[model samples]
Target: MESIVMLSGNVKYTITLDPSVWIFDDRRQDLHTYFHEQQEEKDTLEEYTKEVSKHWDREIIEGAVVPPTLKTEKKYLKEELLTGTFCIPFKPFLTNAEVSENAKNLVIETVDGMVTIPLTVAEKMVLGFSKDGKPLREDGPIHCYYGDGSNYENPIKNVVSFKIE
Candidate 1:
């Protein structure tokens, strides 16, 4: 006879946003159109729009921290070093809201509540690495930003963390 035991643990991640990370722009309308074109039901559309609108004018930042894809790492180091990549998708919003003309005094929110940092913090976070990092394949976090981008800057700060279930 044999006996086996299984145990599992859950972890919660708190992502902090830099103050400089302000919303640069919004594309809610586009998102709404996409859903409508997809033939989504009214309730579905309303729910999607409402949920996404809450974070309207927010920025969506996606990044991946992963190891090198090449096998050359084995020859050089005993352990593989992790690398990261960051990017701002063209369409990051999911509602229909007009763009903002003012970029000052913008609030940046994340999973860990609101925080402030540099405008270029996100870009600085993922610099010096390839943007081809695969979070899904590498078991990394996929961050989404929702805020105004009127005063958005290049290379948004990276102040978020991921928790996988």
Candidate 2:
């Protein structure tokens, strides 16, 4: 006698698992998450600065100087270049920084510590971060301005800037 296969009411579903699928990468995942978090933090900071900058003046710390200001004289205009503004942060030895012409974006290091000048979004993008994901710089023609903070100002040593004009 031939046995008949039962196809009664109950339907059983089988889910096949592929072990080869990428479940987790403790190292790479962590690194990626870290970078993402850093980018978010940077964005938050930039946003906060953009909002708060409308009110307060920008100042940098120097050796035993109480909130030093980096002012300049151009065309007989005694301007508080770094006051209440963002200075452009750049590599200490880059040549393009001279474009500002007022030393408005210039920052000096004192024996006591480092000082930073405020910079605008344009200045920050041009001075901070590389086209290929590297350290902060002050070269190349200015291009692009990121406001939402998906990226960050690559924290280069002794560097910071804020807008003036």
Candidate 3:
């Protein structure tokens, strides 16, 4: 299967996505745990500012203090990269593509056919690229999992590209 997919139509930018690189992306989430957790609403900008402030304070006061668990965390992350199932939520990519306000739906072009979904629903979707630390080479550049977890067991696979309409 091809490792790249494109986001095109009704957008400001045509994006070429390489799912293979997402394995190392910080935005990649653990697919198995994604659905089980309830997401809490928060002001991300505020949270980010607070974290930066804390880091700045520490840098000025303590001259940089590294957590003791840093090494352990790195080790665990390495292990996870070797064995974890992961996914990248599609919201960011769609946002970057700048979907046209007139666009009402997104058509997922697959190897065999296409599936159409509302733009709102498309924003909540997740692109699963890895399973058990392996790329989904048999039938996927990605598998799209619904935002509402309605199709977790059987996601939309064989996706080749997305056309906004």
On lDDT, the candidate that comes out on top is: 3
Per-residue lDDT of candidate 3, residues 1-165 (tens digit): 688899999999999999999997878899999989985545879999999998899789877678677799999989999999999889989999999989999999999899999999999999999999999999897999998889999999999999999
Q: Candidate 1 lDDT, tens digit per residue, 25-106?
A: 2212222123223322246588889888654534233223333643566654322112223323322120112213332122
List of clashing residue pairs for candidate 3: none
How do these models rank on TM-score, best leading? 3, 1, 2
Candidate 3 accuracy as TM-score: 0.88
lDDT of each: 0.28, 0.28, 0.92
Worst 10 residues of 1 by lDDT: 1-10
Query: In candidate 1, which residue ranges exceed 4 Å CA deviation?
Result: 1-84, 89-98, 117-132, 136-165
Q: Give candidate 3 regions above 4 Å deviation.
A: 41-44, 53-67
TM-score of predicted structure 1: 0.21
RMSD after CA superposition, every candidate = 19.5, 27.8, 2.1
- Compose the digit string of candidate 2's lDDT tens values, residues 10-118: 1122122111121121111121223344332136578778877643443332333443233323422323211211212222213322334443432323223444444
Model 1 root mean square deviation, Cα atoms: 19.5
